[model samples]
Target: RPAKKELIRSGIVRTAGRILSSAASTPAAAEKTMALLEKLSTCTEGRAAIGEDGECVREMVRRLMKCSGAATAHGISALWSVCCLARDAGAQAAAEEANGLTKVLLVMQSDCSEYTRRMCVELVKILRVKSTTSNLSPYHSRTTHITPY
Candidate 1:
């Protein structure tokens, strides 16, 4: 964990993000980079670094499906980190704009853990809610559930 922080301190996350978009980077390399990014996302500086790097967010969404199974999981976990854990609205919007919802749903149907699936569901719901609330109808405003207490 400390190693990850030190790497973040060294500003390597941007280089890692660049690797994600480079054609010369192999699948194994990409996976390793993603795993590192996923681990780094646990820290505030890491999440901030990811959010600050426009390529990091866009390339993550761009390479969502092209990577291997573990890479996909790590990528999704990284996305969940910045978008959900850090509550980054811009990242959420970028994911939504890139049609990451379909990708998230597809990954949810795969062999990932329930926690990851829950993250996928939350990402979908959060983006959906944000998109809908912009032009909310009366029914959307009213609570579907009612209680007398």
Candidate 2:
């Protein structure tokens, strides 16, 4: 049997390709695949679900955003779905670091598409809401809207 890292890497690659292709081929299937990808976007081996090579994930998301059809909505929604999972696994640090996750969210906020902007705002809210605590509440409240994304 291969190491878990190998298995995960394979899955990541497979999912990335599926997400890209699904952007055009099948919105329903794409949504489902995106869900799985989001699930995989959890902490693993002291790293993030999206892993160090987030370029692939980011690119896929960028491509999805580039789409101007119904598919784009599904893809953006799918990305949002994963942000919750990522927040859960990686915690505040995940949101703060984790390979430009915040940057992507900010970019989505400014997306020409209204749906994408709404989705990005929602994702930021989710991260802030989920991670807020007595000690961090003030910090989050003050910086939530001003962070890079």
Per-residue lDDT of candidate 1, residues 84-135 (tens digit): 8898877777776666767787888888878778888777666666553333
Output candidate 2 Cα RMSD.
9.3
Best by lDDT: 1
Clashes of each: 0, 1
* Tens digits of lDDT, candidate 2, 1-149: 23546756566645564555453645565545554444444335312445344543554454553444454555445446555534443333344343234444546655447756777676666655544442433454544355576
C-alpha lDDT of residue 80 in model 2:
63
Native-vs-model 1 lDDT? 0.79
**lDDT for each of the candidates?**
0.79, 0.49
When superposed on Cα atoms, how far off is each prediction in RMSD? 5.1, 9.3
